[model samples]
Target: MNSSMDLLQNYIQSFGYDWLSNVLLITTGSFFLWVIWRLIYGRLEALADRTQLAWDDLVIKAVKAPISMLIWVWPATVSVGLVLATHSNDDVVWLGKIDLILVISTFIWISLRLISNVEAHVLDQKKRDETTVQAIAKVARLFFVTIGILTIMQALGLSLSGLLTFGGVGGLIVGLAAKDLLSNFFGGMMIYFDRPFKVGDWIRSPDRSIEGTVERIGWRMTIIRTFDKRPLYVPNSVFSNIVVENPSRMLNRRIYEKIGLRYDDGDKIDAIVDEVKAMLEQHKDIDATQTLMVNFDAFGPSSLNFFVYTFTKTVNWARYHEVKQDVLLKIMAIIKKHGADIAYPTQTLKVDPIAMARDAEQPVGIVER
Candidate 1:
């Protein structure tokens, strides 16, 4: 027993014993973490397969379970064991500082990954709904990066208040330099809250007179896909200030036009109006509740002008055009059936035949003919 004790004491005194113990601890911790990772990943995969929710699958795909698990668990386990292995007081202090850094970094990494997972899962639900999720994802990423930076600085023994003061001064300068940018950023927030238009909505602005589908509402700008298949990036500030018309939100739209008839055809004006009102009532695309008016608006020099107004039940541009074309064709046929003609600008020239005859009769007198 004395010999065994002596041998144990000798081993403890040697540097090799301490190194070996640390190695064993590290290996054990690593193996334990690996096992935990495999178990958790396996369970997550199984749950994803069995669940009816597609978002779960998205979460798994986004987080990449194995990588996420390692990011969280590896540092924690290693730091714990390293803290336990320290002997001297100075060594313990150094190990504590190292552990602090490891813990903060690990937490930051995990937080960032979790945010990514949430974004990916939400976006995978639908294409149009992804716009809001994408914007939120950008904001979340920025927030996490800021947190990570602050945590790192704190770990390095820097005063947070001093850093905050510097950041405040810097922010003031940046704010002044980017006033328009700040305006756009706030505009984006207002747009989100106000919800004047959503992604995939077709909108028109009176000032710019641009018509397009909303593609994305971003921090500083809103992207639109124009009718001509071009992308338009309008500043959020401008979007907020403009008078926007969201045609797609309407249930129906009004169509009005004017046609001219010759003054000689005035007798048929009432009949024509009756025919038009009847035609509009019979059409499937025309709204019945709307006031369909056909009136003699004014009289022109060569023609009589009449106004026609009706409501289309469809708000779609293509469908509106189709309905309008059909109505026009029907109107033309009705006019022809009634033996009435459309008129254009015309004028009459008057000539004095008696004066011309007198001039012709006296023209040869000077020659004694």
Candidate 2:
């Protein structure tokens, strides 16, 4: 290596243009680095694809660009230092700091890329909770980035103690200025820890006009896709105060209905109720272990009312509706089988006998042309 360096130095002196020689050497070195990286990265990528472990693929992908940057950085820094040496050693010192910052940035980039790749891989697996994985990835990126910035600050000869003091005071001022933003951020943290709902969960707030599927949860806001297909951007802080019901987590969907029969068929109520209860208990979709009720509930003004309250085994919205329809149809069939019909509102008029007799006598032959 020393002989090679001497030969190159001799060649530069022979040209009597060391600056140009240095630039050419740096350019050539960068080109060779790129070529070397391409060859090595291609093989690694092929190997990663062949391996059963998915982590290797993520690692290879994450390091591809950062590795290339790092390989070029060292040589460039060395060349810059050599050039700076001819001018002044004091100028050469900045090269080390710059080199350190570049190195830190490269690693930070690698860390962030790896986090993203891991998040995607886990989501593709479909076994892990996507919200939790995304939250973890965000946290990991934040941690690595903060650490990288602190390291770079230290390398730049900043005073950690004084900087921390200033940061504390500045943080208080910033917090007060961006209180809502901070609240939303903390609210997001609360969601991550408490976990009342997650991505793809159907949630609704009683106190707010929020009813939708949660698409994403970010630091300041959450994205909800409403049933009408509109995107709702809700501040995370709102979740702190509102009551959110996550129907997605329900174990069973309720089927509640009031079936009214004509008052003339009141006597058949007992048999109809018995048959409905038996049908519910035998129905495969109905969760009989849950609260199931089929009985005479009330006497309406026009009919005898019976309520069928039960739960279905599925929590899926579409599937629950299907089960509910089947149960209702079966109930109607049972009612029809018992010769009872569904009731509608009807009104009967009763007139006094004297008034009816007087009206019948006056309307016989009066005619106005």
Candidate 3:
């Protein structure tokens, strides 16, 4: 490498372009670096694809753009420093500062990209909760960004101790000015830690008209897709105050129903109740371990009312309804098997023969005229 560089320098000097020697050398070096990067990138990606571990692939992807930028940037800066060296030491000093800034920025960019890659990888597995992964990603991004800014500031000859002191005072004012923003941020943090509901979970708030499947959880808000396909942007702070019900996490879905039979079939209530209870116990979908009840609950004004209370093994909304429908149909069949019928609202009237005769005798004279 030294012999080749010397040969190139001698050739440039022979052309009486010794002033452009550094520029040509820098361009040549940058071009070679670009060529090298292109040659290795494809091989690295192919190798990463064959491996089980994802860190290698993530690293390769994260470094690609930064490395590409650095190849040209480092060379150009070095060439500029060499040119400035002959003029003023102060000019070279600024160039060094520029290089330091570029290095810090590149590091920051690579770190952020790696974080994003990791987040995508975890989500693709479909195992971890997306909300949790995103939360972690956000925290990581914030941490890296803060560190990078502070680092660059220090590299630029800024005093860290004074900055820290100023930050401590400014933070209080910023906190007060952005109270709601901070509350929402902390609310989001609480959600990440407590995890009452996650992305894709069906959630509803009893205290408010919030009912939807969670789509995304951000630092200040959560996106929810409602049943009607409407998108709801809910502030995270609101979740901290409401009673949220996560139906998606339920162990079983309840089935409660009231069945009324005709007063004439009152005698068959015991038999029907007993058979219903037995049916529920034998049902594959119904959870026998839960509170199951089929009993003659009350005597309606014109009917004998009974209630069926049970829980289904399935928490799926559609499947639970199907099971409920089957159970209801079975109950109807049992009622019919016992020659009984379901009750409806009705009334009865009775008349005395003596009162009817008295009314007929009093109205006869007007009819004759």
Candidate 4:
């Protein structure tokens, strides 16, 4: 072994240049490292694919990039270290610092990769809505990134206490400057955790014009696709401050309308009310589980008013509309068939003949001309 080392050293020195040695060493190390990486990665990938646990795939993918990078990095690091061994001054200290920084950077990269994979895996397993899952994953990544950066800074010989002292004051100034932005950011966080509504849910603000299916929930704002196919961007803080109605959560859609029939049809009002109730009860699309009211509710000047109050079995907007139309048509048919007319507003006034004659007998109170 000693003789072989002597032969290689002699061959390298035979080149008459010191840098040639380093170049050769790095080239040979990098070549062999790449070969080893290929073999290891291939084996691991096959094993991952064969396993039933899907997390293994994510784990394998997460490491593949870092490990590939490490292959090149390790060889380069070793070669640099060998070269630096020839120097014994401040250069050594500088090289050591660079090496430490590289190590810290590599760790941060690997940690971030793993965090991303774990976040994705957990969200997929939970089957969370797309927008909410994205928000959650971003928050998770941001948190890990913050911690990782701090760790790297500490590894670079930064004093954590000093940084904290400085950052506290700077952070306060930044917070005040970005007050509304921070409110929106926290509002997004609250929405992610509270889950008032999610992607694909139809939501509306009672006080605002924002009404639509949720398309995206980001850190600052949420994108809602409106009924007319317009996209509405609403600030996250708005949601925190307002009352939102999620009609998608409703079990049934309501139908409430008043029908008026002529006063001449008053005799048929009872029969009409009974028949309407029977019709509602027999309708398949009407929700029997909810309230149903069909009664003569009021007397108008020209008509007897009856209200049809019921809930459809479906929550679909178009389906509810169709059901309502069918119900109204049936009611009209019942009214016509029963010799009762649905009335429109009309006014009539008649003065008595005796009152007119008495008024004529008495002198009209009018201005003399």
**Off by more than 4 A, model 1:** 1-40, 65-145, 209-211, 362-369
Top candidate by TM-score: 2
- What lDDT tens digits, residue by residue, belong to model 1 across residues 27-52? 67667777776788789989899989
lDDT by residue (tens digit), candidate 3, 1-369: 224333544454456554567578769978998999988998999999999998999999999999899889866766665555546666345666777788889999999999999999999999887988998999999999999999989988899999999999999999999999999999999999999999999999999999999999989999999999999999999999999999999999999999999999988989999999999999999999999999899989878999999999999999999999999999999999999999999888899999999998885455554
Task: Score each candidate by Cα lDDT.
Answer: 0.76, 0.88, 0.89, 0.82
Better candidate number, 2 or 3, judged by TM-score:
2
Encode model 4's per-residue lDDT on 1-369: one tens digit a residue.
224333444454456767547668667877888888889989999999998998788877877777777667645655554455445332434444555556666666776787788777866687756666677678667887788778778866799999999999999999999999999999998888888998789999889998999998888998999999999999899988899999989999999999999999999999988998999999999997799999899998888999999999999999999999999999998998899999999999988999889888997688988
TM-score of 2: 0.90
Give me the candidate number with maximum lDDT: 3
Mind giving the per-residue lDDT tens digits that candidate 2 earns over 1-369? 234433544554455566657767766978897898999999989998998999999999999989887877666766665566556656455665776788789989999999999999999989998889989999999999999999999988899999999999999999999999999999999999999999999999999999999999999999999999999999999999999989889999999999999999989999999999999999999998999999899989999999999999998889999999999899999999999999999988887999888888885686899
Model 3: per-residue Cα lDDT at residue 116: 98
**How much does candidate 4 score in TM-score?**
0.79
Q: List the pairs of residues colliding in candidate 4.
A: none
Number of residue pairs clashing in candidate 3, backbone atoms closer than 3 angstroms, sequence gap of 3 or more or interchain: 0
lDDT of 4: 0.82
Clashing pairs in 1: none
For TM-score, candidate 1 versus 2, the one ahead is 2
After superposition, the stretches of candidate 3 with alpha carbons farther than 4 Å from their true spots are: 1-25, 79-92, 363-369
Q: Report residue 158 deviation for candidate 1 (angstroms).
A: 3.1
TM-score versus the correct structure, for each prediction: 0.74, 0.90, 0.89, 0.79
